[model samples]
Target: MGRLTDKVAVITGSGSGIGRQIALTYAREGAKIVVADFNEEGMDQTVSQLKEMGAEAI
Candidate 1:
């Protein structure tokens, strides 16, 4: 199991920059991600990547 197994994470401004990185990292740890951001592109990219990594992220 990952470090954050079954955890719920809500990340703001996750469309880019440090926030995005944190969101990705948390998701990789098996946590659910709430991807929020003003940048639609970044948000979509993050969402796609998280899904590819087998994380339940949005």
Candidate 2:
């Protein structure tokens, strides 16, 4: 099991750059991810990537 299993993480500026990377890592660690960012496109991309990793994210 991952360290963050069953945890929920809200990441600001997760649309891109370091924020996006952090979101991905948290998701991989089994945390449910809530991505918040002004850039809709970037946020969508991050969510998509998380999904592909079999991680729950929004």
Candidate 3:
């Protein structure tokens, strides 16, 4: 298991740019992600990508 397994990460501005990248990285490290951003569409896209990686996100 990853070091972040069972951890939950709340990431702001995750709809795009560095925030989004951080979210993805955390998910890869086995953390569940809480995505927050002003851009709804970009947030959804990030969530989708996380799910595709088999990571839990919302």
Candidate 4:
């Protein structure tokens, strides 16, 4: 399992840019992600991408 397995990361501004990258990285490490951003559409997209990668995100 990854080092972050069973961890949960709450990432702000994760709808795009650096925040999104960080969320992706954490997800890769097996963390569940809670994406927070003012951009609802962007957040949805980020969640979709994470789910596609087999990551648990909301």
Off by over 4 Å in 4: none
- Per residue, candidate 4 scores C-alpha lDDT tens digits across 1-58 of 8989999999999999999999999999999999999999999999999999999999
Q: Model 2 over residues 1-58: C-alpha lDDT tens digits?
A: 8999999999999999999999999987899999999999999999999999999999
How do the predictions measure up, each by TM-score?
0.90, 0.97, 0.98, 0.98
lDDT of 3: 0.98
Estimate every model's Cα lDDT from 0 to 1. Answer: 0.90, 0.96, 0.98, 0.99
Which stretches in model 2 have alpha-carbon errors above 4 Å? none
1-58 per-residue lDDT for model 1 (tens digits): 7899989999999989999899889987889999999899999998998889888987
For candidate 2, give the lDDT of residue 26. 92
Provide backbone clash counts, one per model: 0, 0, 0, 0
Q: Which ten residues in a row have the lowest lDDT in candidate 2?
A: 21-30
Residue pairs clashing, model 4: none
**lDDT score of residue 27 within candidate 3:** 97
Which ten contiguous residues of candidate 3 have the minimum total lDDT? 1-10
lDDT of 3 at 3: 80
